[model samples]
Target: MVIVCCSILIISCIAVVSSGMKVSLEVDRPWLRVHLSQRAALECCYRTGAASLRTTWFVHNQPANGTAVPVPVRASDQVSSGYRMRGGVTCGTLTFAEVKVADSGLYRCWFNDAGVFTPGTYLQVYEPLKKTINLSEKTKDNILMAEGFLLLLCVLVPSATLLCKSKQLHALEQKKATREEENIYQGLDLNDCDKAMSLYQDLVANEQEEIQLENP
Candidate 1:
């Protein structure tokens, strides 16, 4: 029973080591974007030194929904419809001479002998004209927003300044008026009681003379 358990443990260790020894593939770019009719390339490399290993390239097109379906890519030595395979042995490169919008997809390099596929690179193709138009529209929007901000500053700054000046002028006018009133009060001689009585008696005498002249 002990021997059987030891054998099982040895088998488990062998399996773990085998799994760890599996070849790992690396891709140069995970995502690539190019304009229509532009050249594009994807490079894949692996550490395994054996040149006899078969490598394959596959493309998965973006779908409306659900899982993407991968299609095998086959190319010959001579450029077959602009698709060509380059590099050798430990590395492989898939290239497109002139990429079309339809060529936009996820690409993966598979090591057939190792039964492993590298993490895919997604290719995106776009129209330059459309991108330029969208950029122009965004620029126009930014310009308009900036102009509106400047206009608001132009209006608000002057209005605030004029309001402040008007308040200052009103305060100054009130102060001037108050000072004039104070000067008028200071000019009065309220302490001259005898002079005031004499003026009142003269006013009464004038009134009596006027009444006599009118009756005559």
Candidate 2:
């Protein structure tokens, strides 16, 4: 009889502890994927009133091999390394302003007073893919041809201008030299004509004196 009574007491104690440890929290979104630098949220709802229980959040960063360590999330209105807590009585939200790859983890919500925790949500943060512009072969060829034409114009235009200017300068120099040569030849011809006139006048005066002497 004493053993039977002890068994009943143990059974009653087990029931009481089980009732106290009953889970009342429900977490939303079993899994989530978000790009880096985007906003992400984890929500927890409870059947019990807010007056009876307080909600808390914890995160476990996924590791490469071993088990992850859980870290408590701090509540704040400003941007923090942790998360911001929002919402009213029935539901609580943990919000990240900008999520990073390091923010990828398992998140759990707990009711400290009720001793209840919701099944965790896994968040995967990924880098966004880079954008690329696709061009057709025809378009690429057109662009290349246009660039080549512009480059050729850039080289040929200046070269043509320099060649024309050099030709003009050479023509001007030749014209000036021709004018100088013509002026020098005209001066030499004028001096030679004056000398011929003086020599002829002296030869005529000597011939007239010889004829007069022979006649006398």
What residue pairs clash in candidate 1, if any at all? none
lDDT of 1: 0.70
Best by lDDT: 2
Give the per-residue lDDT digits (tens) of candidate 2, residues 20-131: 7433444356788998888887776655433535667888875778777888876565223322323533666778888878888888766666655555678899996776
**Residue 163, model 1: Cα distance from true site in angstroms:** 8.2
* CA lDDT of every candidate: 0.70, 0.71
Model 1 lDDT per residue over 44-82, tens place: 665544444466888888788966798987675421322
Model 2 regions lying over 4 Å from their true place: 1-23, 49-52, 75-89, 131-216
